[model samples]
Each structure stands twice: as C-alpha cells, then as structure tokens.
Target chain A: MSKHTSMALRRPSRLSPDRLRVVVPILALLAMLVATGFLQPRVMSYFGFTLLLRYSLPLLFATMAQLCILVVGDIDLGIGPFVSLVNCIVASWLADQPWLCGIALVGAIFAYAAMGAFIQYRRLPSIVVTLGFSFIWLGAALLVRPTPGGTVPDWLIAATGFRTPLVPMPALLAIVVAFIAHHLIMRTAYGTVLRGIGSNAAAVERAGWSLLVGRALLYGAAGFCGVLAGLTLSGLNTTGDPWVGAQYTLLSIAGAIIGGAEFSGGIVSPIGAVFGAMIMLLSSSLLSFLNISTDWQLSLQGGLLTLVLALRTLSVWVGK
Target chain B: MKQIKFASASALALLMALGCHAAKADDASALKDTSKSGIALSNSYAGNTWRQQMLRVWQAAAQQAIDGHIIAKTKIVNADASAPQQASQIENLILEGWNSIVLDAASPTALNGSIEDACKQGITVVVFDSLATAPCAYKVAYDYVEAGRIPARFIVQQLHGKGNVLVVRGMPGTQVDVDEFQGAQEVFKENPGIKVVGTVNGQWTESVANKEVAGILPSLPKVDAVIGQGGDSVGTYQAFKAAGRPIPLITLGTRQEELALWEKLDKATPGGYATEASSSVPGVSSIAFWVAQQIVAGRKVPNVVKVSLLQISKADLATWLKVTPVGAVASPVYSKEWTIDLLKSIAANTAPPPSPGPTQNK
Candidate 1:
C-alpha cells in the first residue's frame, strides 16, 4: 500500500532514464483513466483494451516522430500536416499502383525531409517552415487526386487492418517501430548530440558538431514516421482525404509532451511515448464506449492534456 | 466600247457575289466557333477528390463547349486548404481583373468575407461542394446535411432500426462535419432501433480513424456497421476491418472505384463522386460557366447559386452517374457537340449548360 501510494504520490530519487520515462507516462495514463473515470465512471468498463490500442497507434507513431524533434530542442508544428501530406500521397497517388507505392512512399518521406532541411538549413523557424510545408503538402495532395475518393487494394487492406490472435497489425507495427527506434536512438552519435544540442546547442557547436545536421536528421526521422503512417494508413482506410492531415499535427505534440519529452530539454524516450499514446488512446476509447458526445471528446482531450502537465509537475516534486 | 462595258459589268457582278459569300461564310464560322475562355474558375484548394471532380467536370464542360462560346478560360488555384491562401489567391485574381471566380471554399465560414468581397468587387463567385456561413454567392453543393443523412438512413435500413453502430467524424469544427453530424442525427431520430453506440473524431485522417474505431470495438461488442463522414468513412472501414469486425460499412465520397467496392460488398455506395477528377472539371467549369454568363450579360451576378444533389443508393446511383454528365470526352459519348446538344435539348428556353437532364431532380 505504501509502495503504491508512494509511487503514485511521488517520483523516487536515483531514477534511471528508462524507468523515469516509463513511470511518468504511466502515471499520466493512469491519471487520465482516473480522471475520465471520475468524469464518467462508465468509461472504465466502456473502453475495452482493443479500443485503446487502435486509437493510440497513430498518435503513438506521431509522438515518437515528434519526440525526435523535441529532443533536439526544435518544434514541429507541421507534424500533423506532414502526416496528412504523406497520407494524401499514398491515398491519391498509390491507390491504383500497388508495386509503385513503396517508391512513392520513399519519395513522400524525402519530400517531407527536404522541407524540414530547408527550414533547418535556412535557419528559419521550424514552426513557420512546417506551417508553409502544410500548405504545400495540402495543395500537392489535392493536385494529385482532387476531392477525397479512391479505391485501396483489398489484400493490402486485409494485411494491415487485421488484429490477429490478440495483437493487431497496426499495434504490432507500432511496437516493432518503437523498439527499433529505441535501439537506434540509443546507439547513434547523433542521438547523443541531439540530447546535448537540446540542452545547449552552442556548447555542442563549440565542440564542432553542426546542430543543423542533427536537427535535419531528427526532423527527417520524424518525416519517415509520418510517411510510414501515411503509407500504412493508405492501406488501412477506404479513402484518404488531404484535409485529414490537419488534426494530427497538434496531437503528435501533445503525445510527445505526455511521453516526457521535456519542453525545455534533456529528456525524451520512445518507450514513454508509447505509454503516453496508450493512455491517450484509452481515454478516447472509453469516451466512445460510454457513448459520449463529440463535444466532450474535445473538451476531455484538452482537460486530459492539462492533467498530464500537472502530473508532470508532480513527478518533479516526487523526485525531490 | 460595247465589249469593254460588258466585261466590266460582269467582273463587278462576280465581285459582288464573292463579297456576299464571304460574309455568309464569316457568319457560319462565328456560329461554329463556340468555345471561349471567358470563365475564370478560382478553386480554393485541390484538397479532396470531390472538389477535384467538381473542378474536372466543370472544366471539361467549358473546354468542350463550342469555340468563342460563353464558356471561356480556366485558371485553377489550389489554395492547399489554407483559408488565407485561398482568400489571397482569389483576391489577387480579382485584383488582376478576373471577374468570374468560381470557388470551392476550404472553410465554409472562413471564406465568407473573401467571397463577399469578390461579390462586391463584381466577381461572379460560385461555390461548389461547400457553402459559406452566410450566403455569399451561387453555391451548387450537395445537401450538406444529406451527405451525413443518406448514410445514416442507409445504416438505419441495414440495421433494421436496431443495432449498435459507430460514427467516425471529420474535422469537428468544420461546417461539413457539423452539418453532416446533425444531418445524421436527424435520420437517426426516426430509427430508434439504431442506437449510435459511439462517435469518435477521426479528424478525417485514416490512421486516426483506424485508431479511434479500433479502440471502441472492444467495448461495444454489438456494433453492426460503421458510418463515417467524407474523408473518415474509409478509415472506419479500415479500423473495423483491422479489428476483425467483418461487419459492413457505409461511407461518404463514392467515386466509381468506391462504387465497384460497394457492389462487391453488396453494400450501397450512396451518392459518391461519379464525376472523376473533381478539381479540373466540375468546380472549374461551374465557375467558368457562371462567370462567363455573368460577364457576357455585363452585370455583376447577384446571389450566386450552386447545386450538388445527394446521389443515393445503388438503385439511383446509375441514373446519377448517367445524368451527372462527366466532362467533354468519354470514349462512349462525349463531344462538345453532344454536350451542347444535350444541354440544348434539356433547356426549357434557359441557358444551355446545367439544363437538368431527365434524371435531374431539380
């Protein structure tokens, strides 16, 4: 009981990098579930685990991608539209041509990365550049296949959409991606530089590491995630709409923050992002299960974000 | 003297006959060259296929019209779904003296002032697919609410007035989503048996739709069918499929491909975009035609009107496709002459184009 209360009430000293991340997002997810339960207890049973997995995967991928930017101490307001653009690419261009879809997928990610590079290299504010990129992508998407209607191949649909003997393909994909990301991020010299740059880019520059490359690469990786989601999602849905991209930009940011990518710097983890996404997905799943109005969903998302930040603060206090 | 007079008179008479023939030929050529580039279609964005189709059908109509006709030039601007971008582009065109602006506003409300300004400045603005918050111009749009209600009605029928159903929505604040959601509720009200088990904001993204739909599937074990808004419908179908529901789906935005799928599933595709490539054709052409009509009349068109009726059920889908009049050239029966002939035939002493076909409800 003490351990439960202690863990809930405060963060422990000597926290490991992996452990701190797991704790905070879990706490956040729990807090969300508790708060949601409080708001409407029926949300507990109403939201099944499968529902949680489905809703979180997109945001989960998005958050990890967004985290790549935040860890490098940059903001990507365009993550949402970037995903939208890629989704539009696969939706509009790849629907008819199955074999060429992979090539298009590569092209789309490169396009997103190039846009990110332009911002980082030009020393432009990422926020502004990503905003511009959003418009560019939206237009490009529309240009390729105007209006939102197309046929996705059925076999691709079955392969990506199915949940197997307890694990869905999308959720499994998210797990595999997260694990691979965890390994790659830890090993790369760029990852270390990214953390340092986030802490103090000037000092890292003095040490002769170009923050531009690091920033671009991080943003580039973020773009790749967007593309993956884009292509996978293309196979996942009936049709892709370019306008659909507008929603996830903010969602990725929210999920990353919840995952413990400190807005200031010196903190981020893919594992935590996974948990944050799970919590978020769980909350929405419950909302739908409880049969709540759509208005409440928005309000709850806002409220839940506020609560997560509060828990974050509480984590600091508990650590003390 | 006699010979000279005879030769001179014969030559003069021949010259006169040639002159009259030249005048007749010129008149015939004038009537023959019916195509003109008078219309300027300024689309706000090429963000969706429906809008794309609107642009396509409209453009094809104008292009295939007889030379020097009321249908004139086409300038397509993809605003990238940015309200400011769309507004600015329209404003620029208006400033550049393009008077006939046929627009598909990205945000129905956000584009109001820009459209109204275009109106005040004497640009004939016809909004297609989406409507403004306030009536700014001629809006040829589908029943915005019907876009939502038709699917709702179908599901109600499918579920036999009773079963758990899920709703996947588009962008929450957008006018289309709001109108469609409310429209859905209106139909849902009739069939109390069809209880809306859950509604999730997919935000019109497939990945998000898949996630949201997947999340809810575990809780409501009885959900029979998924109904989604325009962009989000496909996502719900995906999510349900992913979750192994194997339940049927009803989605918005039915193009021919979607039609094929619906038929394959033995489910109704509803009134989807029979008009392929909406942006370059229907939307651009509508703007082109309306603007030309207004410009040729030498009047600032007042209260522009637009029309897009919901093409519903597999039953009505064929008629909708046949009468929808996709642009100038299909392999089967598409010619400027044929379109002109059809429009003229359908005209009740009215403008040739948009002459409602036999299947046209209005």
Candidate 2:
C-alpha cells in the first residue's frame, strides 16, 4: 500500500509528459464546456449539466473498457458490438431471469478471456481476431433480440435514474467510476504487471510473471466494463437495440486516444479517459447549442476532434 | 386562339376566387397566434438518399412557413443514426425551448424516454417516418403493412395464383421489414398456388439486394415472379439479368432508377411490361412539419396520422419518370393545405386526399 501511494503521488512534478497528457484533455473538455455555456447560459445550471451529462455515462464506461485493452497493447475492434450484445441481454433477460442474465454475463467475460488466451497462445494479431469477433457479437445480439424492443428491468432503471440533490447523478457516477478505475489501474501491483507485459513481454516473462494471465485478466476486465456500459445504456434508454451501440467502438477508441492513452500501450489515464468521453459527447451538444446547420454538424465535429488531438500533440512537444 | 385565351382567363379568375375564399376560411379558424412559435426538427440520420430528400423537403417547408408568418423560427438537429445520440439531441432541443419538435427517430422504443421528457415539458412532439411508441407524442407514419399488401396482391394477380416466387425483404429486424413481410405472407398464405421458394434480406439497398439475390438464385428453380420492398426492385432485376434468365414480373419501388428501369423494360417488350410502383414519399416530412405547427397553433390533431403511400400505376409511370431526377426518389411535396386535409380525413374516417404527381420541370 505504501509503494502504491508513493507511485500515485510521484506525479506531482510540473511539465511532465504524463501530467501534460492528462491536462490537455481536461483543458479541451473545459474549453468545450465554456463555449457551450457561453452560447446557452441555461446549460450552466444544475439541470442543464444533468441533461448534458446523462448520455455520457455509457460512453464513459465504454471508453474505460477500451483503455483497459489499449493498456495491454491490444485493440478491441469488437467493443461496440460486444456492448450491443450486452445491452440486448440486459434488456431481454435481466428483467425476466436475473440468474440467466448473471450466468450469461459471466459467460461473456470468460469468452473474452478465452479469446485473449487464444490470440496470445496462437500469436495471432489482435486486430484481426477482434474484427472477426465483432461480427460474431453482432450476430449473437441479433439472435437475442431481432428487433429494437425489449423491457429494461425496473430495478435497473431506478438504479440508473438515481439522482442526487447536489451533483447530478451522471456526473457523480462518472467521477466515482473514474477514481475507482484510476486506483485499480494505477495503484495496484497487478496493473503494473499488466503494463509491464505491454511494454516488454519478454522482460515481464523473465521476471516470472505470466503474460497469459495478465492479458486474460485485462480482457476480462474490459468485458466487465462493456457489460456495465450496455446495462447502463439499457437503463437509460429503457429499451434495447442491437445496432444502437455500433458507433461506440470508434468513439471509445477516439476517447481513449484523446484521453492520453497510446496505441503503443503501457500508458493510460482513467480520469482522463472519462474526461475524453465527455469531451467527445458534449462537442455535439456544443454544436447544437451554437445552432450549426445540420449539414455542417458532422464535419465540424470531426474538425473539433482533430483540433483536440492537435492540442494533445502540442502538449507532448512542450513537455519534451 | 382569342376565344381559347378568353376562356382560360375566366377559368384562372374562378380558381383565384376559390383560392381566396379557402384562405379566408382558414384564417377565421386560426386559434393561437403561431407567428411567434418556434418549431425544430430532430432527425436521426441524414445519410441516405431517402433521408437527404426528407431533410431537403423539411427545410423547404419550414422556410416557407417562416416567410409566410406561420411560425417564428425553425431549426434542425441531426444525429448519426444512433439512439443515444438522438436521445441527447432531443434533450438539447427541449432545453433550447422549442415550442414543437418533429422527429425522424432512430428507433421506435429507444427514444421513448427522451420523448416522454419532451412531452412532460409541454412540447408538442411529432414523430414521423420512423416513429416512437411514446403515448404522449403524435405519430405521422406510413401504412407499411398496406405498402406490402399492394405489391404482393399485384404479383399474385399477375401470376394467376400459380407460380414460383421469390421474396426480397428489407433490412432484417426492422419494424418496417416485419410489417411488410407479414402483409406479404398474409396474401401468399391465402393463395395456396403461389410458392415462395426463397427469401433474402435485401437491406433496402440496390447493391446489397443484387448481391444477396445473386447468391441465392443459383440453387433455386426457375423464379417466375419476384416481390420486393421498395429500393431493391432494380437490383433484383439486374441480378436476374446477370444470371442470363429472362426478366420476370418484378414489383417496382418509386425510386427513379426503378421507374427508369420500368420504362426501359416496357419499351423493350412487345407487350408493355406491367408492374406497380409504390413506396412512402420522403415528402412526408413536410406533413410532420405541418402537424407540429398546427398542434403548436392549438389545433386539435390526432395522435396518429396516416399518410398515403405514393403509388404509380402503368399509365402514370411515364409521368413519374419524366419529372423524377436521376438518383432521386419520386415524391410529391406535401403542402399545408394537403396536411390539414389529411388530418381532417383521419378525424372523419374518410379517404385522405390524393397526392399529386410531381410537376414536370422544364
């Protein structure tokens, strides 16, 4: 515990690349929030923040899931479809048979872990395997709920609907989840092992750590986050759709990247990923508040994303 | 020539007088001053030709209403065909304090929560094309079941109830697909002579339909007729032609490509190629716009308003082909008068007014 505290507290220095990486996303997020607030002052209020942040919950979880995979030098092209499948199960089975839902969710986690083992053992490219699995996940989701109608359990709805008088429920949940993820991934010894494997697999193996176990554990964790995302999405939407979360795979990758996670692996910021997710989700709201024409909204959103990434690159250069 | 000119002048005068009288009647019944009311459109996706046409139609209609002092302002927000994105857009629309929202939803049930929130805020919500199941929101929708039944009926009659048929379906797991397939099955089940030898998911696109049909065509026996959801008829035709089989009687959609194909095929054959063309018009967005405006103006509108599908018979095919531009869906723009008449007919349980054909562009 002392060692973990020291490592967590060691990042107090100014002008560090790691610190700058996290700060850039936060600054981008704040900039977007200010721009939006300037345009629509109503959105500056408590109710306004609640409305703006409500839909970001699922995305935040998904981005964390992607961050887990990215931390281990693997990319999950299947996260979106996996989340969609979980959404189908949550909406269809959770209300009717909670036991079945539990079993199915656990079974999915194992499936993800097994996929990790298979890919590692066979020395297969993760991108190819995950891409193949995406189709399988989409097909399974369709089989579970062919159409876009399913009843989310009342308890689940109430759970997602939980509101606080002070901070909005979604914002509070986002911060809590971010801290938990940050603690687990940054302060835990096992997280170091995961990161070690990503940076130097042979060194980790030479250190008597099992690379297979680390990869499987991280993949399982990702699966768990994906399931959470799907459940929260179902609760919020109050229904299920097999195709609803299809856009999330790319969004999560972008969020993870924007949040200072690297494709080269061994680097991720849980809190930054949450902020990154918020930035991505709220930019559209900002555009909407600005009353941009519908034809130009999408292009402007892309431009904003590019701008944020450029800022991130500039921050890294400054830190250097 | 002088006599003809004088007669036309009197007819034009009578028409103008009648038009003025209709305007006077409409003005007297206007309850609320909607001149200060604002309406917004929350569209789910603007990716496809159909949705693009729908947005264009809405923009034109909304601008006209604004210029005519029917509404104070209008705005549009489009999402990326995702339920969560659209739900967020709807929430933002509510916060923006729009008096009315017209929606082309991404999903029927996924948007209910946001729709309910909008309704609770006292916003007039009108969902069209792809509708929401929320009780508070009004729906302006197509009779997709009837849309299915008509073409299937046409195919059954043409085949004399005895033929091997192929069913080219729309996107799987969609309500529209289910309804249309159900309606087609109802007719086919009633007639025992028609055998549905094969079925493929066309996904309501020409390229996908072509590939799916081509993949399934080799194993099946001779296909006498093909029944398709709109947008796939041309593809089904192309698939059959590529396979070196004689083109059978394939039902057509209202796509310009389909109509153009119909014209080409009709002229090529000794006897005219006969097939029916029918699909929901993208201009239904204008109807939804008008519905929202009328509701905001304090007019009583039904919770569910049905718009008729645009149907093209053999004789009208030439007219549709003439006016329909390449790569555009054949649709007649809906006017405010037409929408009011539609609402009145729905309330009175009578047939809605007939949709006019597209005016020939010089």
Task: TM-score each candidate.
Answer: 0.45, 0.87
Model 2 C-alpha lDDT per residue in residues A195-309, reported as the tens digit of each score: 8877788999999998888888888989989988998999999988899889889889988888888888888889889998998888778878888775786687677667767
Chain B alone: TM-score in each candidate? 0.65, 0.90
Residue A311's lDDT within candidate 2 is 74
TM-score per candidate for chain A alone: 0.82, 0.92
In terms of TM-score, the best-performing candidate is 2
Docking class of 1: incorrect
Q: Write the per-residue lDDT of candidate 1 for residues A228-284, one digit (tens) a residue.
A: 666555554435556655656776777777777778765777777777767665655
Cα lDDT, all candidates: 0.60, 0.88
Interface RMSD of each: 18.0, 1.4
* Predicted structure with the largest DockQ when compared to the true one: 2
